[model samples]
Structure formats: C-alpha cells, structure tokens
Target: MKKRFDIYKEHYKALISLGLPIVIGQIGVIVLGFADTLMIGHHSTAELGAASFVNNVFTLAIIFSTGFSYGLTPIVGAMYGTKLYTFAGQALRNSLVANTLVALLLTVCMGILYWNIENLGQPEELLPLIKPYYLVLLASLVFVMLFNGFKQFTDGITDTKTAMWILLNGNVMNIIGNYILIYGKFGFPELGLLGAGISTLFSRVAMVVVFVIIFLRSIRFRRYKVGFFRLGLSRTVFGRLNGLGWPVAFQMGMETASFSLSAIMIGWLGTIALASHQVMLAISQLTFMMYYGMGAAVAVRVSNFSGQHDTLNVRRSAFAGFHLMVALGVVLSSIVFLLRDYLGGWFTESPEVATTVTSLIFPFLVYQFGDGLQIAFANALRGISDVKLMMLIAFIAYFVISLPTGYFCGFIMDWGVQGVWMAFPFGLTSAGLMLFARFNYMTKNR
Candidate 1:
C-alpha cells in the first residue's frame, strides 16, 4: 500500500510540475475573456450579445486551427524524448508552414461567414458592433496560429514557462488596452466593441513577435534554432503533419460547432439569451481551459513515454492528469454554483441576463466530469497519434447526438436555452467514455 501511494504521489507531482505553468497561462486567457465580456457588457448588453455571436462563430475556426497546431506537439515531444533535437526543430518548422496554411483557410471560412452574417438570425441592432469586431478577430488568426506553433514547440520540449510568461504578459497588455480603447480612458478613442477587438489583435501580434525574438535570442532555444535554420521543409513532414492535423482539427471543429451552432440557435431566441450565453461561456472557459491545460501535460508526458516505449508511464500519466482535472472540476463547479447569482451580475446589469446565466449553471456543472474525461483521454490518444478514430467519435458525439438533442430540447420541446445547454452533458459524457475506452484498449494491448 505504501508503494502504491508513492507511485500515485509521483504521478501527481509529475503532472502538476508540467501542468501548472500551462494552467497559469490558460487562466490568463480566461481572465482576458472575462475582461472583454465585462467591459462590453457594461457598455451595452447589445454589444455583449453581438460579441457572443461573433466570438462563437470565430471560436470554431480558432479551435480548429489550434488543434491543427497540436499535431506538432506529440511529434516534437517524441523527438525530444529521443534526443533528436534537429528532427524536432525540423518538425516545428514544418508545423509553422502547416499552421500558416490553416490560418489562411480559417480566414477564408470566416470571410464567408462574415458575408452571410446578416442572415444568421442575429439581432439587427448589433450588426455594426459584430462586423468590425469579427473583422479584427479574423485578421488576427494568422498571428494566433504563429504563437501556437511556438507555444507547442516549447511545450513539447518541457519548457512551458516561456509561453506562460508571454501569455500572461500579453493578457495584461490586452486588459490595459481594453480599458484605454474600450472606454477612451487614456486619450484613446472610445471604440467600444471594436476597441476590445483591436486590443485582442494587438496582443496577439505582440505575442507572436515576442515568441520569435525569444526563440532567436534566448540561449535556451539556441540548439533548436541552429537546426531550425539549417533544415528545409520536407514533403514527408508536411504529409505527416497534415495526416495528424486534419483529423484532430475536424474533431475539435465538430465539438466547437456544437456550441457555436447552439449560439446561433440561441441568437434566434433573442438578444437577452445571446447575452446570457456569452456570460456563461466566459465563466465556463475557466473550467475548460484548466482541464485543457492539464490535458496538454498528459499529452506531452504520454508522448515522451511512448517515445521511450514506456507504456506503463504513458497510461499512468494520462490517468493522473484526469484525476487533477476532476479535482479542478469539483472546485470550479462549486464556486460557480455557489456564486451563480453574483457571477452573472459581474458581467451585465440585466436581471434577465443574470437569471439566464444562473439557469445555465446546472448544465455547466453536469458536463464537468464528461468534459474532463474527454479532454484527458483525447490528449492521450493524440500522444499515441491515434487521431483518425477521434474524428469519427467527435462526429457521433457532437453532431449526431448533441446537436440533435439540443435542437429537440430547445425548439421541439420548448425548453429554450437551458435545454440546449442540457444536451452538452450527454454528448460530452459519451465522447469521454468512448475515448477512455479507446485509450485503455490501446495502452493495455501495447
């Protein structure tokens, strides 16, 4: 029993060591989102609602691009584990190219959405706010992707602190910019929603630039930089990246689509519903990003272990990460539940929006276990490069089960926005179970 306890303790420490920096970085991002929502909500509930709709639309593309960039992590992690520094650097270079392509594709897709924005059943009064905000966000996608490539590369090398510091610093700049531009507090034009968008764009651009400078000048990355400049892109590298990237991208895209599409459905209900959804989503991101931060550690550890052919450690790391995420879910859900009433008011003055946010908290709590489970196991699978199956599972879970259930509950059964939220637990839990089973089977057989 003592030995078992020691093993579990070691696992916990390892996961936390890797995950803490990532969690801190993710918290910074969540804080930025909160600041954006709160500022916009206070300015105008209509602008808040518009931000919700526009953000939800772009979130799908952003998540997809992020997933695509994640293809680099496991590859780089494995190479780093094998002490193949040059190979890892080459992979990172290829990832940059691939991510840039993905950014362009996402931009085109967003452009299409922008052209058809008026027909999405959103409030007409908010179009002016949504249009400029969407455009600025769309323009920032390439920079976001660039930052992701650098971040994943560093994370794979187990140097997570660099990205963490950069993200936190960028977030501080973003919040300060939001204050100055959103309200014209510092001789800046009161740009309102557009100001928030501009702040985000500036922050993203700065992050990428800083990352590049660090990669070039920092001695920590000197070895990787040496190889990075010497290597040329290879077709094999591109193909491998695409093979892993596309499946993960589509899986995440489908999952995000479930929420994004639901946002559209909520928009059909009214501005109040959309505004409430925005506030709730901003809160929920706190939980999701925490889980994802730990999940990313699991991927990094599992990939490293897999490269060393240490199946036991790979499985142990994945489960350990899940355990941490479960704990996080408990704490986050408790806080959100206990403060549901006050939490909503932090973002908006509307009693109706507050009440709606309060109503959505139950569904948010219901899906926490499922969300943590799926995130952990999904990263586990990614570590082993078992991505093709994830695409099918995501489609079944999000598209076949979740979306239909939400539509049925929200529209057909007249349960409204809360009902749509209810469908998340079913879909997320199903996906989690499927992914867990797959990971178990893979690890056991190996």
Candidate 2:
C-alpha cells in the first residue's frame, strides 16, 4: 500500500507541475470570456443574447481548429521524449500548415453560417449585433489557429509556462480593451458587442505575433528553432497530420455542436433564456477549462511515456490527471451551487435570467463527473494516437443520444431551457464511461 501510495504521489506531483500553468492559462481565457459576457450583458440583455448566439457558433469552429492543432502535441511529445528535436520541429511546421488550412476551411464555413444567420430563428433585433461580432471572430480564426500550433508545440515540449504567460497577458489586454470599448472609457468609442469582438480579435492576433517572435528569438527554443528553419514541409508530414487531425477535429466539433445547436433551441425560448444560457455557460467554463488543463497535462505525460513504451506510467499519469479533475469538479461545483443565486446577477440585471440560471445549476452539477471523465480519457486516447474512435463515440454521445433527448425534454415535454441542460449529463457521462473503458482495455491488452 505504501509503495502504491508513493507511486500515486509521484504521478500527482508530476501532473500538477505540468498542469498548474495550463490551468492558470485556461482560467485567464475563462476570465476573458466572462469579461466579454458581463460587459455585453450589462450593455444590454439583447446584446448579451446576441453575443451568446454568435460566440457559440464561433466556439465550435475554434474548438475544431484547436483539435486539429492537438494532433501535433502527441506527435511532438513522443518525438521530444526520444530527443528527436528536429523531427518534432518538423512536425510543428507541418502542423502549422494543416492548422492554417483548417482555419481557412472554418472561415468559409463561418461565412456560410453568417450569410444564413437570419434563418436560424434568433430574435431579429439580435442580428445586427450578431453579424459584426460573427465577422470579427471569423477574421480572428486564422490567428487563433496559428497560436494553437505554437501552443501545442510548446506544450509537447513540456514548456507550458510560455503559453501560459502569453495567454494571461493576452487575456489582460482583452479585458482592458473590453472596458475601454464597451463603455467608451479612456477616450475609446463605445462599440458595445462589437467592441468585445474587436478586443478579442486584437488579443488573438497579438498572441500569435508574440508566439512567433518568441519561437524565433528565445534562447529556450534555440534548438527547436534550428530545426524549424532547416526542416521543410513535406507531403508525407502533411498527410500524417491530416490523418490524425481530422478525426480529433470532427469529434470535438461534434461535441461543441451539441451545445451550439442547443443555443438555437434556447433562442427559441426567447432572449432572456439565451442570455441566461450564456451566463451559465461562462460559469461552466470555470470547471471545463480546469479539467481540460489537467487533461492536457495527462496527454503530454502519457504521450511521453508511450514514446518510452512505458504503458504502466502512461496509465498512472492519465488516472492521476483524472483524480485532480474530480477534486476540482467537486470544489467548482460546490462554489457554483452555493452562489447560484448571485451568479446570474454578476452578468445581467434580469431577474428572469437569474432565475433561469439558478434552475440550470443542478444539471451543471450532474454533468461534472461526466465532463471530468471524458476529458481525462479523451486526452489519454489522444496521447496514444487512438483518435479515430473518438469521432464515432462523440457522434453517438452528442448527436444520437444527447441532442435528441434534449429536443424531447425541452420541446415535447415542455421542460424548456432546464430540460435542455439535462441532456449534458447523459451525453458527457456516456462518452466518459466509454472512453475510460476503451483506454483501460487498450492499455491492458498492450
């Protein structure tokens, strides 16, 4: 027991060392989103609702692009473990190409969505706010993708602090920009939702620019920089990236679509419901980002272990990350639950929206376990490069089961937004269980 305990302790320490920076970075992102929602919410509930709709749509694309970039992490992580620095750098170059292509494709898709935004059944008044925000976010997509490529490369090398600092700085800039532009403070024109979008775009571009400069000049990256400049992109590398990337992208995209599409359903309820949904979602990101940060650490560790053919350590690392997430979930859910009444008011003054947000807390609590489970094991699978199955699993969990259940409860049973929220527990739990089972089975057999 003592020996086992020591092993677990070691794994926990390792995970925390890698995960803390990432968590801080992700928290910075959540803060930025929270700032956007709050500033826009107070500007006008209508603008808040429009932000929700447009942000959800853009989030799906962003997540897809991020997933595409993730393919680089496991590849580079494994290579770095073997001290194949040049090979890893070459992979990063290929990742940049693949990620850029995905960004362009997503841009086109977002444009199509923007063109048909009116048909989505949102309140007609919200369209004006949505269009400009959507376009700004669409323009920022390429920069986000570029930053993801650099982020994954850094994360794969187990130097997460670089991205962490950069993200936090960018987030701070975004909030400052939001304050100035949202309220016309500091000699800035009040642009409302458009201001929030513009701030986001500027921050994203700045992050990418900073990452590029660091990669080119930083002594820490000197070795990788040599390989980066020397290694040219090749068809084989591109194909490999695409092969690994697309499945992960589709899986993540489908998972997000579950929520984004549900935004449309919530819109059907009215602007107040949509605003409430946005507030709840912003709060929920507090939990999700923490889990994802730890999960990302798991991917880095597990991939490194896999490269060394240390299956036992890989399993241990993944579980260690999950343990952290479970604890985090408990803490976050308890806080959110205790403050549920006051939470909604932080974003908007609408009593109706606050009440709706309070009503959704239970569903949020119910999904925390599932969310932690799926995130941990999904990263484990990514580390092992077993991404193909994720697409099918996501499809079944999010689309076949969750969406239909949400529709049944929200529409047919007339349970409204709270009923729609109920679908999350089902879908996330199902995906989590399946992913955990799959990871166990694969590791055992190996």
Each model's Cα RMSD: 0.9, 0.9
In candidate 1, what are the lDDT values of residues 122-205, reduced to their tens digit? 889989889999999999999999999999999999999999999999999999999999999967899999999999999999
Mark the regions of model 1 whose C-alpha exceeds 4 Å error after superposition.
1-3
**Which predicted model would earn the best lDDT?**
1
Candidate 1 achieves a global lDDT of 0.93
Compose the digit string of candidate 2's lDDT tens values, residues 1-446.
87877888989998999999999999999998898888998999999999999988888999999988889888999999999998888888888888888899889988988889889999998888889888888999999999999999999999999999999999999999999988999888999999998999999999999999989889888778766778888787788788888888988889899999999999999999899999989999999999989999999999999999999999999888898999999999999989988999899989999889999999999999999999999999999998899999999999999999999999999999999999999999999998998899889857
Where does the lowest 10-residue lDDT sum fall in candidate 2?
222-231
